[model samples]
Structures are given as structure tokens and as C-alpha cells.
Target: MALSVVGVVLCALVSVVSSHGYLSSPASRNSAWRFGFGTQTNYNDNELYCGGREVMHSQNQGRCGVCGDNWRLSEPRPHERGGVYGKGVITAQYRSGQVIPITIRISANHGGWFEFRLCNNNNPRARDSQQCLNKQLLTFADGSRGTRYNLSRSLRGDVTVHVQLPPRLSCTNCVLQWTWVVGNTWGICSDGRGKVGCGPQETFVNCADIQISPKRGFQKPTTTFNKNKNNFLYPRVSLVASVWFAGLVATIERDLEEDVLQTVVFLQRESIPDQDLFIRGGISESLRPPGCSSIVESDPCAIDMNTNLLGTIQHYEKYNAWRVGDTRLDWSGAQPGQDVYQGIPAEGTPLVWTTNNVLSPGYQELNT
Candidate 1:
């Protein structure tokens, strides 16, 4: 018992001190230091694979937190999205269909494979579920859709790739996630019947809140995805610039708070991400989760507001969802372009209606 106690204590220290690899560029949610978050940050942002196999294989049954958090908890922790972290901070911004280079810093190289996925969830008040991110798997924009990272062979430190954001897709707060499943662990098969070099292994993830907007000279494409699975959205896109919100609400409540619910209706500009938050959703062919496209249900102008009462405090049961909408549209030190929802719902702001003849609902609000 004493030995086991010592071992457990040692493991906890290791969890905080050392991690294999992490997303160093574009500022992931776990790694970046936002003023709103104070000093509350995950010291071991890279070591997040269900607390290693001891917890992953034994306790959680291969489950993982959407943003590389420990799987033992029933829900995401405080540092996770929708978990009352830095007010759903937006770290970076990019234009849809632009190729941007992503850098991964490997501290301890464990031969493995990594993948990048995005969930265009605009609401800054909900957890970024794994089911939602699975729908849109990102690929290298250089025509390498089914990208197989060659990390398993030699141990390299930094790996950078240029990827293109989906065309014609925009979001106020999108979760840009990077997951790396380690390839070192050897284990028995699921049946426990046969041995394998790569049955189950440690996984790591890091996420960043990002905003994607329409390009200056871009027009909405009428064409659907290409037949070839490799190039799902568009043909090979050359390197242009780069990459990139929403998650949980607040734990505390204020006595009086002012808010606004707005919509957008413009696609022809240098760029217009401010009014695109509610442009995508159950347009409901698939039975995916709510806010898959955008929280507001449909866009250039989505409301992202729900049935919550306008001017009064309410119980958890009083809101459509405890997680969908937020109080503020901006963050503390928001960068110029990274600031999405710029002219968004505030106390004094009035609700924005869709432009005439834009083929939109009269309004798109019903979210938080």
C-alpha cells in the first residue's frame, strides 16, 4: 500500500511536469496565456490521453475529452471549453479556403500519428463534443486530404503543415483541435486475445478558439463536395496565411446584465465574419448535434439567442440550454482581425435583421 501510494503521487507529478508533444503555434486553448484566464492554465497541456492507459483502458474504456482533457471526469473541467475558462477566448483568425501553416512542438517524441479537426460551433457557451468535431476532418490543402503523418519512423521535433479552412464556411467561434495518438504502446487486442504493436496507445490534444470569415474576392460556391474524398471542399490551395471559440458559460451570475441578439447578411467585402455566426445548422438533413454549423440555426445573420427571458434572472430550467449563449460578444485584449462578433449582441445593441432578398429567414436568433 505504501509503495502504491508513492507511485500514485509520482504519477501526478509526472503528469504536470512532462508531456510528449503539443500545438505550439496559433495558440491552443490549453497552452496560451490569456489575461482573462489569469494564471489558471494547464501546466501539462500536451499530456492529455485519458490520463494514460491506466485510466484510459481500465477506467474510461477508450473515451477521451474533446480537447485533450482527462476522461475520468463526467464533464469537462474548468480549463476546458464551455467550462468557464477565459470567456471563450479567440486566439487566432483566418479566412476560409486559405492555406496556413501549423506548427507542432514535440518535447518527447513518441512515434505516433496526428490529426487536425474543426467544429464550426459558433456558440461560446457549449462544450465542443467529439461527435461534433468528427464531422469535419481537416486535410492538407496541398491535395493531401488523407494525410498520413510520417511521424512514426524518425523522432522529429517540430512538424508544420499548411491546411485550408473549409470554403464557404464561417463561424464566430470555431474549435480548432489537434489530436495525436501515440504509437509506442504495445498491447493486446480488444478481445485480449492477441498481441499487437499498436493496439491502444496514449493520445494528446490541444484546441484553440478561432474565427473564419469570407475572403475578399471570394463568392459562395454552388458546387457540392468533390466526388474524390481526398479533396473534399476544393482543389489544392496554395499557402496563403493561416489558422484559429465557443464553449461553456459562466459559473457565477450577475444581478443585471445587458445583451443583444443580432444577425448578418453580407458576403461581398474584404471580409465579413462578424455577421456569419448563425449561417449554418440543421439546414437538418443529418441528425447531428445542435450548432453544428452555427448556433443561430442559419446566416449571413444568425441570432444565436434562445428563449431566455430578456430582463430577469432565471433557473437552469428556464433557459433553452445552459450552454448555448453568452453575455459578451468580445474578449479583453482582442486583436484586430481575431475579434469576431465585433458588432454583436450587447446591452445597447439592437437585434440585426437579415437583408432583403438574401434568401434567409426573417431572423436567425433562438440559441442561448
Candidate 2:
């Protein structure tokens, strides 16, 4: 009997950890991260606003928490005009036409889809009221109504949704609703049958208080694509060549009097470009110097100087391949001297060289 009880308890614990998530971006009402204001996992019912068990109908009063609610440990405080949390201040302020980053934190991977809804209810408590539920389903700037956006058809961990707020939204204070509905209950079962296939749907809902103002000449962000029309060589090529040439010049200028080992060390440090144009371009074999096109073991200049530069270049290329989602590149082959110049050791393989038991600080500083 004790073993059976333990097994049931373990199964219950596993179910609790299976699927849980909450809105993290635009700062939800529970974003303050207090003890009671965490993820609301009791999403079996339609508690759309703040995911609270009891529905809040008044703008002055807050949501209620059931005493033995097993889903979450604490209940979020009321976030209305005269409520205790946030002091009635808007959680976030933005203008229409701005790309708002919506981040959702998922504790466990579950098959589901996300829905974003917007309503111009300046009053916090009244926003999620039953009367306002239908009114808040906004017609987005693109003329789409009722669940403006959907993401992740399958199970996923953490995800971010970038959405441009409708330019038509000119409300002073508004509530943005985020709803996550579990796609299907495959493992959950009871009475020798699937307890819930995908019937009513287990849904998690949260809201963010935002103030949207008139657009003040805000231009939508765009990426500028400059054609490499000049000599077919990219700015990255010149940058790499310059670093290599600089190191060579420095090595020669300091005279053969400088220790070869010390010069190599200094060159490695000094040759590292201060900018991150190399990795941003997605490092590949195509970026190799034009002069050092093929494996020219015979050409002394290509073999010695270019090979050394290639080593440095390959290091960054390997780092880029590792950072970006490029599974094709053989990261294991990114060892120094893998691409040798005659008998001499060429560039160090990517991410192999380290300082203080970590990759060079420069690689860590890249924005991407």
C-alpha cells in the first residue's frame, strides 16, 4: 500500500512539471516576480484575466486565489486602478507601429499555440471583465480580428514573438492579453480512456498593462543590404587581410630581435579585430583570401604568411559556426594546423586557443 501511494505521488509530481508557462515580455501583471505573483498553472477553466481562479468584476477589487490551488504556490495580487500591485501605473509604454517583443517563458515543453489579444480598457480591473471579453478582441492593423497572432504549432521550450502593434491603436491605456492553450493531452488519461483529447482545451492566460500614444514619426526598423559591388571582395575580406598584414608588419618592424614565440603571442592578441564583422557575415570557406585561393604549398608567401592569417580567420569562423545554427560545419575539424602550410603550423582551430580557461574575451563580446 505504501509503495502504491508513493507511485501515485510520483506520477502527480511529474504531471505538475510537464507543462507550465507564462508571459515574460511587455511585463505581465505578474512580472514583478513577488512570491504570490508567479505562473498560474490551473488553466483548465476559463480564468482569462491574470489566470486567477475567481473572476474579478470590479475595477477596485483584485483577483482571488483558492486556498488549496495545487497548480501554483502563491496567488498574484490584484492589478486594478486602486489595487495594491504596481500602484495603478502602466507596466509598459509604447507607440503604435513599434515592434513589440513578446517573450513567453515555458517551464516544460508542451504542444500548444499562443494567442495575443488587445483591448483599449484603461481601467485595469474592468479590462478582463466578462462584459469586456468580446470587446477586447481587437482588429489588428492588418485587418485581422480574433486572436491576431498564433505561434509554435508543436511543443517548444521558451519562445519570443515579435509583433508590430497596430498603428490604429491610439488608446492612452490598454490591456494586452496573452493566451497559451495546450494543443493536446496525449499522456494524461483516466478511467482507461484519454481524459481530455483536445476538447475544451487547457488554457493559460495573462495580461500586460500598456499605454499606447500617438506615433511621433517612428519609422519601422529595416535591415540595409549593401551589394558587394566593389571588386567582389567584401569589407570583411579587407578587414581580415589588414589584420594579417598588420601582424606581419609588426613582427618585421620589431626586428628579428623580438622573441619569435613572444611575437607570435603578441600577434595573436593584436591581430584580433576590434570589430565583429567577421562572425556577423557567417564565416565560411568563401571568405578565404583570393590570393590564397587553393592549397599553394609551393608559393612561399601563400604558404607562410597567408596560412598564418588563415589560422586566425579560421578561429573566428569556427566561433561563428558554433554560435549560429549551422550544423553542416564540422566544428571538430576546426583545430589549428588542420589547414597546414607545407610543414609549418597554420592558424589555430576555432575556439581551441584560450586565455584563463575561456575563449578570448573578444569572441564573448560579439552582440550576435
Candidate 3:
């Protein structure tokens, strides 16, 4: 009719920009991440009383939103209490190393025997926070994923504590919870719940915000048109395996067993004020203790300098590879510079990334 209604409004604007670039790719931005509530669940878990799927049964399943009953889904050892929980209380706060999981819902008939100690909110209550710490990060109840000690009662409703925090301790006040019931007991709780002292209302479900950047290597710029020559030197590595940022893709097995010899410099884009520029050649060196068999300096440099910025974000998606130079040296392998002005001797000393513009405060020494 009128150019067919302008061709159906340009095909609905190209199907809403191609469904927002396929749900913002990167594996759909890890399921569209959007959950931020340290307290969401007053009660509701009798298996939905009959039907099911309303709230409180998680291995990443359902509920935590809103629903109520005797409230089911709190099993690490909560029937009353048992074993496996050395001590507790942690309050970490860094931001962006990614490890946020947290889920603790407790209300077991409200009795006595209590000892719920899940850490990393600052961890240091006196040399190992009083010992007993078993690792795996605790989170039990048959559903497995460690860190939720045994508050034995035979186990049932109320008590879902799952913790995995890295993103610099992540903050909206950066989550923290530790409840060791009845004498020898500990404190420090804040992941939802303002005032409910008869004890039975401890909710904190942060879920996702993990973008760890402990990155390491993937060097590829002797300068010449910079195309990633031979690629696989420090090829790729970035982890958090579960909620996003996988990008492994490495290769260079000089007989294999962790043999690449350092070379981690990358940055095809993503320049948060010059986020590091680019430089890599086996970061500094030191340490080698797990059985020890040579390859000593201990073991510092390997993969993960943002794994070629996620392979240049899978072919130039956005960029995020920063780590070019300035004493942050934590690598330990490669050392052979004949050119590039001959100054290639940094298996350790070099850390300078922060220079896109605004050069004041003497560039604040690149914020270290």
C-alpha cells in the first residue's frame, strides 16, 4: 500500500536489532544476568505444597524470588546440626575477580546447636579464624557445592548457604554472613534481613556478578601490523567457567605439561583510560612447591592475560585485555629479546596501563 507500510516498519526495525544482538552474546551474557537480592524468601518450600516449582529448591533451579510455606530447600546439614564447619566470619571487598554465589536461608524450628561459618569477607579472626576450615568453600545438603556446614536435625527447610565470591568481594555492601550458633558462636551477618532476632530470617541471594580478571598471557605484537603472529604464544586464558568468560583456546605444547614460556601482551581495544597498553614475556618469577619436579621459580606465568582478550572478544567484540607493564610482574618463563629495541627482560618488573587522556595528577602514576 504505501511501500507495504514501509515494509512492515522496516521489518519491525530489523527484529528489534536482531533481538539485541542475540541476547548480547558471550553465550547470551550468561543467561542475561539480573538478580540482586540478599533477602528474598520469607517462607515457602514444602515442594510447593504439592505442585512444585514456586521457590526454595536451588542448584540453580527455582525460587528465591517470593513464596511461602514451611519453606523448603535449606540442606547442608540442617535438621538440627552435625559436623563439618570449622569456624566463620569473612568480609572481603575488592571488586571484579568474580566468585559471587551466596545463598543462606535459615529457620530450623529455631532451636539451639548452631555453627554456620562461611568465609571470605575479610577472613582473619585470629590466625585462620579459629581453625576447622575445610575448603571446597562449603555449601551442602546433598545438592553439593560445599560450604554449608551440618546443623543437624536430620535436615529440612531453611538454611541454604552457598558462597563463591571473587569480583573483588563484590559490593552492594559486598555480602557477608557467618552464624555459629550457641556459645563459641560467631557473628557478622548482612546479606538481607534488617530486624528478625528470634533467629530464622537470614536471606542473601546475590547469585551473579563474576568477571574475574586474574588474566595472564597471550602475547602477540612485535609491532609489524600486529596480527597475532603465530598466535599460541600466550594464546588465551580467562576463567570463571560458570557464569561467563571462558575463552581458553591455548596451544604451544613444548612437550606439554604447562610449557609455553610466557608472552602475555594484548589489547586490540577496550581501553578504560588506556587500561594497560600491552606487553608480555613471561612475567617475573618465584615459587614451585606441589611435588616439585623442576620448572621452578615455582610457577607464576601461564595462561590468562585475559586470554587474548577473549580472543580479541571473539573477533573484535569489545576488548578487555589490559596488562602491558609496570612492576606487577607475576609471570615466570620466557626471556629472549634480540630486538624490539632489545629491552626484553621482564619476567617480572613492569606495570603501566592507564593513559587514554586527561594527564593530570601526574597521571596518578597510572593508578598502579
Candidate 4:
């Protein structure tokens, strides 16, 4: 009898420790990450469950946790929104009508249905609750609603879903919450009148911080343009204007056709510091160079070091990519700035940006 009790306890421990899932692509709060926010890295991030088998709505009258946590339970699990993920870092930015992919990794197969929800937290820090996220049940482009991923049983593996963002919704302090509610657990109904599987069950949650704005790309470059006019080469986004110590400044002008974003880039090679750090900066919107009248169009995302102070904000300038000895911002297929150098050139020009905004193996982004 004693051995049987011990075996049961060990099995419960094993059940809790193994076979859970999390957002692997967008880098959930529990996921392993290096940049963005002060977070403690969890290499084994998938082990956390929302309520697990402990807190059932029928038995405990417990509420589900926000962001893969069960903080409101009788015996609450850790509040993931407060612990490792408190400093909600904006992992990604997208257009309101964009279709993005969410990938989930399940180490052990547990019969359950999963969901992805959103909360446009008014708080800049993205401190949203389960009540807030419940308002925005995200729907995949394929018409699968949140909590509608009813999995009867399945193999343990990675699952990727291509989800579409709502056409009208936009949020700076956005929380994309992923939850997995287990289905295998058997329990009495909330009223103690229903059959098995009619009560509370195991659940897991994970939240990813992101930003979404209405189509900010290149539809109206001269007018309303991509709000984040970041330099393609140097990848650190600076909130303050004067703190940007390196790279070119973008003064987006010239309204063109759909999906074709054309920007007049300026590189202030003079103000750049002699260090491993590189910073990308953006200037005020509208008009020509710093004068708003003396504009020069050399190539796309390239300037011939033609003039000083390219925009009205006379803080930064654009230079020729060949002059800097670095790769181009090839997002628009521009040939001038698209050259790639495997090493730091003999002239010691920092290859701050990458081929398509993705850094190479050696290049690292330094925060401002």
C-alpha cells in the first residue's frame, strides 16, 4: 500500500513536469531570448502550464490565468505576467491586415484545444489580465476561432498556424496570448450534473508582446508612411532623436505605387563613434533634405554624400553604401545598397545592417 501511494505521487510529478507547449516563433515571455526587455531566460520554457490539473473551474471555481498563468486559482500558479515577462518587450511589429505565423512546440502529447487571443492593453507596459484578453479572441485566416482548436488527441510535435490580424485593430501595447486547455482530464460538471470532460481541465498560457498599426509600409511614403522609419543597416531603434550616434537618417518622401517604399536616406559618417556599436535613426516626416527644398535622388536608399543635413532636423545625413563599405537595405530590391561584405572592410567601415534586415552570424545589435 505504501509503495502504491509513492508510485501515484511520482506519476503526478511526471505528469506536471513533461508534455507542455509554448509559442516558439514569436518568442513568448517564457521562451529563450537575448534582446528586448529584462527577462530571465528559461531554456525549458515549455514546462509551465496555466492551471495544470490542480485548479478546476468546477471544483475550485478558479479563473484561468492570463498569458499562460493561473494566478487567480485557489492555489495560484506563478503570475507569468509579473515574473520573467514583466518587462513586456515588443518582440514583433506588423500591419493590422497582415498574416503572420505562430509556431507551437509540444514536447509531450496531451489531448487539448489551444487558442490565441489578444489584448490591446492601455498600459504602455502591456499589463493586461485574462478579462482583457477574453475580449479579443483572435481568428486564424482559415476561420478557426480562438478556443476552437479542439484537439481530441495528437502527436507531440511543433505546430505552426498562419494567423491574420484584424483589419481595424491596432495596438502599441499589444499582448498576443496563447493558451492550451487540456481535454483528457475527467471531472464533474460545474453543477455536478454533466458527464466526464464537462468540467475544468489542465491549461497552459504564454504571452508575446507585439505592435500592430494600419498598413504603415510604402503606400503613401510622402504622406502617411511607415511610422517606424528605421534604418535598414543599423538595427537599434532609438526613441530619442539626439541619442542616435551612427548610421543614416530616413526622411521618407515621394509618394509612389502600392507596396513600393522609397526613402531618401542620409548617413552622417562624421558623428559615428569608433566602437562596436551602431545605431539606426529616423528624422521628422515630409519634404526634401534638411532644407525641405534641396532634395537629391541618387539611387534607392543611397546618397552620394551630396550634402550635409538631409532633413529639416539637421542631425543626420545619408551616404553612399559603397563609401561606407557595407551591405544595403535590400527589402525593395535596390542595387546601390545591396552589397554584402563578409568581413569588416580594410577602411574599418562597420557593417551595421544586413542583407534583408537579418544580421549575419557575427553581427550583434547593441541597445541604446
User: What local distance difference test score does each model get?
Assistant: 0.52, 0.42, 0.26, 0.52
Give each model a TM-score.
0.56, 0.39, 0.24, 0.53
Ranking by TM-score: 1, 4, 2, 3
lDDT of 2 by residue, 267-329 (tens): 233345564432122122443433432333332112111112223465555333333222111
Which tens-of-lDDT digit does each residue in 174-231 have in candidate 4?
Answer: 7888878766566777787756456677777788877665455522334433435433
Q: Ten consecutive residues with minimal summed lDDT in candidate 2?
A: 300-309
Best by TM-score: 1
* Candidate 3 Cα outliers beyond 4 Å, as residue runs: 1-103, 106-135, 138-265, 269-278, 281-297, 300-368
Once superposed on the true structure, which residue ranges of model 2 sit more than 4 Å away at CA? 1-13, 34-81, 123-133, 136-157, 184-197, 217-368
Q: TM-score winner between 1 and 3, please give it.
A: 1
TM-score of 2: 0.39
RMSD list, candidates in order: 16.5, 22.3, 21.9, 14.0
**Could you tell which candidate, 2 or 4, scores higher by lDDT?**
4
